[model samples]
Target: MSSDLEPHGRIGVVRLGDALDWSTAPDVRTMVSTMWDDLAGGCLVLDLAATTFCDSTGLGTLVSICTDSGERGVRLIVAAPPPGVLRMLRITGLTAFFELYDSAEDALRSARAGR
Candidate 1:
C-alpha cells in the first residue's frame, strides 16, 4: 500500500493507495500522527478514491484517527471511499461518525467554508 500527503493551506489531504488492511493501517496511523502538529485545528481529508480494500483493522485505525482529530480540534473527513469501504462503514454504523464526501474537492470546499 501507498499513501501521499498533500497539504492545501490548512487542509491536509492524505491520498491512500489500493489497500488499507492490517499491514498498512499501522503505517497510516503513524503517518497521520506524525503530521498531527501541522493538522491540528484544521481539516483532514482521507482520500480513499484509489483504495480498493479495507479490513477491520483499517476501520479501527480510521476511528482512532477520527477520535484523535476531534480531541485536537481537527475536522476529519473521509472522501471518495469505494463501495466496499463504504459498505463496511455503513454496516459498522460509522457513517454518522465520519463526514463523508464524494470527492476530495467537496471535502475541501466544505472545510474551507467551515462546515
Candidate 2:
C-alpha cells in the first residue's frame, strides 16, 4: 500500500495492498521495480502484512523482484505477508527464497544484523 526508502542505504519497504490480483499486478511490479534504480545496492524489504490476497502474477512479481535483487547483489526480503499470500509462498516453495518475518521492524533488524 505504501513504500518507504530509507536514505543513503539500499533498504526500501513496500507495503502490499489488500488486492494483489491481475488488475494491480502491473502497478505493483512497476512500483517495486522502480525501487531497484532508486536504491540500487541496498536491501529491499517488502512488507506484505496488508495484503489480503495474491494470485500467480502477484507471486511472480515477488519472485522477479527477488531475482532482480540477487542479480544486483541487493537482498530482497518479504515480511509479514498475509495468510493467503503466505500460503501461496509456501505452495510455491518461495518461503525459503525470502527471509520471512513477523513484522517490518523484525525484518529490518535482521537485515541490519546480517550486515
Candidate 3:
C-alpha cells in the first residue's frame, strides 16, 4: 500500500504499491472498492506509475474493480503506468476498457469534471 485511503472530496486517489501482483492485487481491490463505496458516486483515480510489474491476477482484479464501479454507477480512472504494466494492459486489451491518464492530477481533474 503506497498510499492510504487518501480522499480528496468525492475523488479518492489510491497509490497502488510498487508491484501489483497476486500478493497485492487483492488489497488493491479492497482499498479501491472500500473507498468507492465510502465516497458515494465512487470517483477514484489509481496511480500506477510507481508500479513496476502487474501479473494476470492484478489485471483480473482491475477488471473486477471496474465492474464493481459500473454496478455502482461510476468509472475508475488509472494514471501513469510503468512500461511493463502498460504493455500488459495493452496486450490484454484492457487499455480500451479503462480511462488512462498521463498523471494523477489529470485523472482527478477529469473525475471532478465528470461530476
Candidate 4:
C-alpha cells in the first residue's frame, strides 16, 4: 500500500495507494474524517486510482463521510476509482451521491469552478 497527500490547486487531495480492504478501511475513514476539520473549506479530493478493491465497510465509511460533510457543507469528490469499487458504488445506487471525476485534475478543476 502507498499514499500521498497533495493540494490540487485549492482542493486538498488524499490519494489512497492501497487496495481498500477490511483491515485498512477504518484507518482510512478515521484519517479522512480527522482531516475534515483541518482542510480549508472542508473540501477534499479523494484520489482512488490505486484502490483495487473495497468491501461494504469501505463503502459505508464513504457514505458516512458524505453524510457528515453534507451537514457541514463540505464537498468530497472521489476520483479514479478502480472498476470493482466503481461497480460497488453503482450497485448501491450511490453514484449520484458524490461528485466523481476521471482524474485528480478533473476533480480539482470542478472544485475550483464550484468555489
Residue-by-residue lDDT tens digits, candidate 3, 1-115: 6544445566677888778889998788767766766666757678887888888898888888778878876668888888888888888888988889989888877887883
In model 2, the worst 10-residue window by lDDT is 33-42
Tens digit per residue, CA lDDT, model 4, 1-115: 3334445443567788666767887787777766665564647778888887788888887788778778766788988888898899999899999889988788878877874
Error of 3 at 7 (Å): 6.2
lDDT of candidate 1 over 1-112, digit per residue (tens) = 3434445656777888888999989789887887778877788889999998999889998999999999998889999999999999999999999999999889878988
For this target, which candidate reaches the highest TM-score against the unseen true structure?
1
Per-candidate clash tally: 0, 3, 0, 0
Count of backbone collisions in candidate 3: 0
Every candidate's lDDT: 0.86, 0.83, 0.78, 0.76
Q: TM-scores for all candidates?
A: 0.91, 0.90, 0.87, 0.84
- For model 3 the local lDDT of residue 88 reads 87
Clashing pairs in 1: none
Alpha-carbon shift of residue 77 in model 4 (angstroms) = 0.4
**Candidate 2, residue 74: how far the Cα is off, in Å:** 1.1
Please tell me which model should have the higher lDDT, number 3 or number 4.
Answer: 3
